[model samples]
Target: MLRVLIIAQCALLSGVLVAEVSAADPGSRPNVLLIVVDDLNDWVGCLPAHFRANGYETAGAGKIFHHYQNHPSSWDDFWPSKNLQFPPTHVPAKEYQPAFDRKPRPRNWYMDFNWGPLDKVVEETGDWMSMKFVSQKLQEKRDPSADSGQAKPFFLACGIYRPHVPWFVPRKFFDMFPPDRIQLPPSKADDQPVAAGPTQLREVDAR
Candidate 1:
């Protein structure tokens, strides 16, 4: 019998769920599945590596770490490999539009900040590809024949890189919230200076 432990870590939410197998004899080591979002950037030490060293197969897919920072030894296998850490961007059709004016911005601004509904399907995105890879790993019931050939515990990590920047989700999601029914909080003039402070600084730095 095999036991499973699911650890879900999203933006600000962290949870652990222990699932017991139906068989009477529980396995020695329980498989661990860690699902991370942008929070993966905060991981200084790789938990998967620790588990790997302790006789568990470790595998990962997607943005487990920041593009610049990666612990290769952490996983026995990983998607996109080391050479191609950041996957190709998914460009939508010409008809699909951006939320912003698409005007030139200052170099000081590192990440592109914008929001809009994409005309493209979710499957076209790199995240979806990584998700499919991880999904395949999760469906594996036993180790490969090259290995011990028995049911082996594994430490699997999946990183979802959505709800972060560029906010270009599929139109289906946006349609769920009708524009007419949406509401915005009351705004004060006093808050404008503080809110626009960052933008002003970027403009000044560019010049």
Candidate 2:
């Protein structure tokens, strides 16, 4: 009876079933590493510009490093030397305008230095490095019999936030791309068309 039901379902959803079946499996549920960087353009070593600039210094270096180093290392080690040199904490420059808090009260609350919100979430929630942490915490709750063993092939995600506004990265990252060397995008001629709406110009002239 169950076989007949499954066959009918498969006939109805043949496309979906075919896709699921044909999907590549790297064997034993291959580990996934999802690294989400906030507002990060494709400026990493993997990109073509990096190769043009650095001449593939670290190309295929990961395979070599992984073979040598033990499993699970600091996230910083994976990055280039320049990236690792970020300031322990970032401080905005004098000309910088505060986006969140405009007017000053007592202390510069917004300007005050601290790791961004996502970092706090990782530290508070679980071990930032371990892939097994997710399986144990997130998956094991629903199914007590579910394998939480480290050998059960896993996934890990490490998110690094920087090079965003306030431009508060390490002095080294800033120094790496000097203003003279930096390539600016071509300016479009009158790209922003003004929308026809209420005119404040008359009121301003009257004042």
The number of the candidate with the highest TM-score is 1
CA lDDT of each prediction against the hidden true structure: 0.52, 0.28
TM-score to true structure, per model? 0.57, 0.22
Question: Which lDDT tens digits does candidate 1 get at residues 1-207?
Answer: 012112222211222122222222223322222323223324433466557767888877777654334467677878777445445445332333321224344433324443456666878677888888788887663435545556558887777777666556788889899878999778675677432433433321121
Residue pairs of candidate 1 with colliding backbone atoms:
none
Best by lDDT: 1
lDDT of candidate 2 over 1-207, digit per residue (tens): 323333332333222231343322323222211121111113232132233344322111121111122122222123222233221332433323333234333333334332122213333321222323334434544565664543232222232323322233334444456669888777555663231111111121111
Steric collisions counted per model: 0, 0
- Least well predicted 10-residue stretch by lDDT in candidate 2: 32-41
Cα error of candidate 1 at position 11, Å = 14
**Residue 202 of model 2, lDDT score:** 14
